[model samples]
Target: MTGEPSSMFEAIYAGAEAGEAKPPWDYGAPRPQLVEWAEARDLAGGGREALVVGCGYGADAEFLALLGFRTTGFDFAPTAIAAARRMYPASKVNYLVADVLDLPRKWQRRFDLVVESLTVQSMPPEQHTAAAQNIAALVAPEGTLLVLATTRDEGSEVKGPPWPLTRAELEEFASGGLILRGVERIESGTWWRAELSRGAGGSTSHARQF
Candidate 1:
């Protein structure tokens, strides 16, 4: 079972259930960084598996299905999952209400591609590494992981339920034998897009669920 809801994010989308605005991060479209990366690499899933962590409203998840992936996108917030299903009733993407902190055992190292954008930053700094580990653990052998986040200097101060991540924090995604392949700062260093890959047959047993 998934853990408890993210009260902050839950409240935000809960407002949407009452006909209020979606949270700022819900772009109603796929993440541009992910599209660019996939397009440039000529990445095509061709029925391969993909997972999107903290998939708020299912935009990225639906986008992957268009590229031929058997995609599963999940969010901790029940409201968010409901919104996704409501938004894309005919979509092939599987939208689930699941928490990154508590994933199913069958998911370990099971996805050919994993896309995670902005989800880690929504969590507090204390949970960053654990979130990273779980996200990384979902990648299959020889598969790839893509991560995007709002960027900030390590010592920078900001008032937030959405704390922008530092470079070191982004690096934490290379867990359980996943290699940090490349990293780029975009929009004048205000955003981070990172690509990581796991060596085929490497162990993902180091990952833990809490």
Candidate 2:
């Protein structure tokens, strides 16, 4: 973690410039744990809009749209955005190319379900707070933020575009006024699903069939 690049932005941009195809992060299918969690929680039907960060290829965004949420998928890579638009055309999903740190301020408090699947941890360690804050800002008061990402095992070093988070790191990322509601592991525990609400109030939880 220490000697790794101080930020992922540079690497992402370099990949874009070099036209790197099939970045390891683009796993073809929507991450299963994320898909399963979203389907099970009825999060896609939540009243407000949803924003999918690091939406490479947009399989997750399409899935979210199919579940009835107005979805906005954004990535810094134009190639990825183009691919996403092509893949999800005629669907009600909006795909754009943008940096997560510089999103329009108007988007603040704009979403009910904010999906941060495999995104935050992809940034360098220095970016965790900013990523967390940005995700938190997008959640409307009384909205939910669903997080699905890989976590580092105990005593492991963090070096990555997929910089895995430890449970403590995950908790810290969600610390800015968002309360954790539920947690579950996926695929032999390589990934995790966490549902968080903006404030402390309704603790009720249930899964929705997709």
TM per candidate comes to 0.92, 0.80
For residues 69-145, write the lDDT of model 1, one tens digit per residue.
Answer: 99999999888999899989999999999988999989999998899999989888789999999999898887889
Clashes of 1: 0
* Model 2 C-alpha lDDT per residue in residues 29-49, reported as the tens digit of each score: 787777767656555464347
Q: Go through the candidates in order and give the clash count of each.
A: 0, 2
Distance from true position, residue 152, model 2, in Å? 0.8
Stretches off by above 4 angstroms in model 1 are 1-5, 203-210
> Which numbered prediction scores highest in lDDT against the true structure?
1
> Which runs of model 2 end up more than 4 angstroms from their true locations?
1-21, 42-47, 200-210
- State residue 193's C-alpha deviation in candidate 1, in Å: 0.5
lDDT of 2 at 159: 64
lDDT of each: 0.87, 0.72
